[model samples]
Structure formats: structure tokens, C-alpha cells
Target: MSPVVLFDAALALGVLGCAALALTLRDRTGTVAAFMLTGLLVALSWLRLGAPDVALAEAAIGAGLTGALFLRGARRLGPLRARPPAPAQAAAAALGAAVLSAALLWAFATAPAESLYPPRVAAALEDSGVSNPVTAVLLNFRAWDTLLEIAVLVVALLLVMTLSPPRVIPDKLGALVQPFARIVVPVAVLVAGHLLWQGAEAPGGAFQAGAVLAGAGLALVLGGVRVDRRVLRRALTALALAGLAVFTLAALASQAVTGALLGYPDGQAKAWIIAIEGALTLSIAATLCLLFTGYGRRSAR
Candidate 1:
């Protein structure tokens, strides 16, 4: 077989094996570890599909953040996580999975070869503001979808705030962790900014930038860095709202200037998109970090 086909076959086997192991693993922590492996394999599948943006998202939110969350929960739950599911529950789950897989296979097998949106997007690219087709689609062509996605993040943060947020790190690794974070967080920030800038012309964008910033935040949190609780709460709330506020105001401003909402002025699409994405990246990062912080039982709350 060709190298590409051989590689794909290996990746497919790895993904399937990991997924099955994740489902059958008895220990909660081991299950989470297997699931993380599956997520990484799925991310590689996205890369193979030639979708770097989707791959980045899969790596960041899917594999990275999810693994961290599961690890945290596993640490807390300990032996309770290993409790076996009811036999009926396990059987039902298996049946559901089988049915869903069959349905998806049937859909794809019967579907047409062509898509309806790509041609339209290509035709409209020149006037869509950003040079990158993905960026233009997100921040210009289908801006309402982007706006709603940010709003969903805002809603998630608000929901998470119903519980106490982090007051301190769960377990401080060591003095070495602080120095390590000092080295890594700055680089993460620089990379995030670069991704934001590159999004206008490449596969990077606000989501990827936000995910990098969230990783930095997670590292700092786990490294025992924290602000006053009140300050942390207010700052997180503001950051969580930043994207929505900026995006909504921008939409209004656009509507006032143009005849439609989110419509950038002629030839000024790049500038507008950059400004919106800058705000969005910070908001998404903070929101994601907050979700992690509020996930489990709080200490001394």
C-alpha cells in the first residue's frame, strides 16, 4: 500500500481500539486515559481530512481540555468511578451506539457526492472580507452563526457560575512548575496572538488562539497561581462577556453603517474581523478556563 493509505489504516485501527478500550475499561482514570487516546486519534483523522482548523479544535478542546477535566474528576471520585454500570444500562448503551453507527453509515452511503455550500462560498470569497475562506465564512459570510456560538460560551459560563469557582490550585506540582509556567505561558500567549493574526490568511483563527490561551490559564491555575476571589470572579465575568459585548456592538455599528447586521464597510472587512476576533479569543479562553474551574466540588466554598 502507499504510505498515506498505510498510515490511515494504522490510525483507523488505533482509533477503533482506543474507543473500545475506553468504553470497556473498568477504572475511571484508565477509561479517561483511553478516551484521551481516542480523541487524539480522531484529531489525526481530521488532519487526514485536510481540515487543520477542525484538527486544532479537536486537539485543544476535545483532547486537551477534556483530558484535564476527566483527570480532575478521576482524582476526586477515586474508587467510586470504577463502579460498574447496571447490566441493562450497559446493554442499552451498546444498542444505542450500534443504532447510531448504522444510521450514520446509511446516511453517508446514500448521500450525494456534492455539497451545496462550498461553491457559493468560493464564488463569494473576494467580497467576503477576509482572505482565508474559513475566516471569511466565520466572521463575515455566516457571522450570525459565529455570534451565536460565542453567545453559547457566554451561556455556559453563566451556568457554571451557579457553583463556586476555583479559589486555589487543586494540587500544586512544585516550585519547578512555576518556573515551567513562566517559560510556557508567555510562549502560549505569543502563539495565540500569531494564530489570531494568521487566521486572516491561513488555518488559524480565534478558536485556536482562545484554546491556546485557555491552556496557559489551566497551567497557571494548576501551578497555584490565583488572584483574590472577588477579583477573579469579576475579571472572569468580564472576560466571559467581552466577546458578546464586542460582537453585538459591532453588529449594531455595522447595521447602522450598512443596511444589514454584521455587514462590514466596503474594503474594511479585515480590520473589523481582526478587532472582533481579538475580543472573541480572550473571551473564549477565559470562559473555557472558568468551565474547568467550576467543574467539580469546590474547596472550602
Candidate 2:
């Protein structure tokens, strides 16, 4: 077989192996580490599939932030003490997994060789007003879906708030953290901006940009940065809601002008998309940050 095929096979195996290892590991930290490794492998698979946008998201949110969250949960839960699975239960699980794998392989082998949607999307790209096919599809061809996704995020934020989880106070790592944040945080902001702007024509978008900004915020928290709790809370909540509010208002404006929700005027699709994406970036960043740090106020350190 070709080297490329060999590499692909190894990556696929690595993902499966890491996932299984994560599930089998009794130690919480080890399991979290294995899961994060699996996410990185999945991100590589997405890149190999020619979806860099997905790869970026998988790396940032899937591997990075999600791993952090898992670590936090593990810390809170303390040491693992659960007994190993019974031999019979393990055998049954193995049998069930084998059956599911076989079914998936059979479906993949039987799947059609061609799909009709790509050509349709390409044909509509110019009308959608974005050179990037993914962006066009997301912001124009299927905008209602994107709008609903934002609404779902908002709902998730509300649910998280209702729980009133305690704020995350990062353990002091040393003086190096302050210097690290000073250098890294500014770069993260610039990178997020670039990602948001280039998303119109490149493999970057609001989700990726927002995730990066959230990472920066997490870093600031870790570095023991201080800001007034009241102001920070107000700002975060407003920013968290801004995306849905702006998107809804824009949809209404579009309906007024073109008599269809999110239908941009003949010459203004790009503007509409940029405006919507900007709001989404802020909202997504705030929402993710809030989810991580929680809404509880911590006295300034």
C-alpha cells in the first residue's frame, strides 16, 4: 500500500486505540489525557479530509477546552474508585462493539460514490456572496440552521447559569504565568480577529475565532488577572446574548427588505454575513468563557 494509505490507517487505529484506552483507564487524569489525544487524532483526520475549519475547531474546542473541562471535573470528583467491569459484561460489550463496527463498515462500503449537493452548492456560491463554499453554505444557503444553532448555544448558557456553578480559580503556577499571558493573550486576540475576517474567503470562521478568544480568556484567568466582578459579569452576560439578539434583528430587517428571513439584498450579502459573524464571535466567546468560569463572582485576588 502507498505511504499515504499507511499513514491514514495508523491514524485511524490511533484514534480508536486512544478512545478505548480512555474508557478502560481507572485514573481520571489518565482518561482525560487519552481522550484529549483522541480528539487531536480526530482533528488530524478532519484535516486529511480537507476540512481545515473543522480541524481547527476540533483542536481548539474538542481537544483543548473540553480537555480542560474534563480535568476540572476529575479534580472535583476526586480519585477514581469504581471496580473494573465484570468479565461477562466486558465480553458482551466487546460483542456489541464488533457488531456495530461491522454494520458501519457495511454501510460505508454500500454508500453511493457521488453526492449531488456539492455541485448545487457550487452553482449557488456566487449568489450566496462568499467565495468560501463553507461560509456561503453556513451564512446563506442554510442560515436558518445557523441561527438555530446560536439559539441552542444561548439556551445552553441559560441552563449552565441556572446551576450557579462556582467560579474557576486557577492555581498559581508561578510568576511565569503573568509573563506568558502578557505575551500570549495579545497574540491570541490578533489571531482571533484574523480568523474572523478571513472566514469570508478562507478556512476560518466565527466558531474558530470565538474559541481562540475564549482560550485567551481562560489563560487570563489562569494568570490571576483581576477586574471588577460586577463589571465583568455585566459585560460577559451582555456579550453572551448579543449574538442571538443581533442575528434576530438582522433576520427581521432582512424580512422587511426582501420579504424572506436572512435573505440579503441583491448586492449586500457580504455585509450581512460579516455583521452576523461579528456578533456571533463575541457571543460565542462570551458563552464559552462563561461556561468554563461559571457565573459566580470571586473576590479579586
Best by TM-score: 2
lDDT (tens digit, per residue) of candidate 2 on 1-301: 9999999999999999999998889889999999999999999999999999989999999999999888878887789888778999989999998999999999999998897899999888988878889889899989999999999999988997887677787777897998899999999999999999999999999999999999998898778788986698779989999999999999999999999999999989999999999999989999998888877544221
What's the CA RMSD for each of the models?
2.4, 1.8
lDDT of 1 at 114: 86
Candidate 1: misplaced stretches above 4 Å? 81-96, 165-168, 295-301
Evaluate all candidate structures by whole-model CA lDDT and list the values in order. 0.87, 0.91
Could you give candidate 1's per-residue lDDT for residues 1-301 as a string of tens digits? 8999999999999999999998787788888999998999999998999998888888988999988888877766665435677999999999998999999999999998887988898898998777789899999999999999998888877777765544335564766998999999999999999999999988899999999999999888888786775687579778889889999999999999998999999999889999999999999998988888784345621
How well does candidate 1 match the true structure in TM-score terms? 0.91
**Over 4 Å off, model 2:** 297-301
Model 2 residue-pair collision total: 0
TM-score of each: 0.91, 0.96
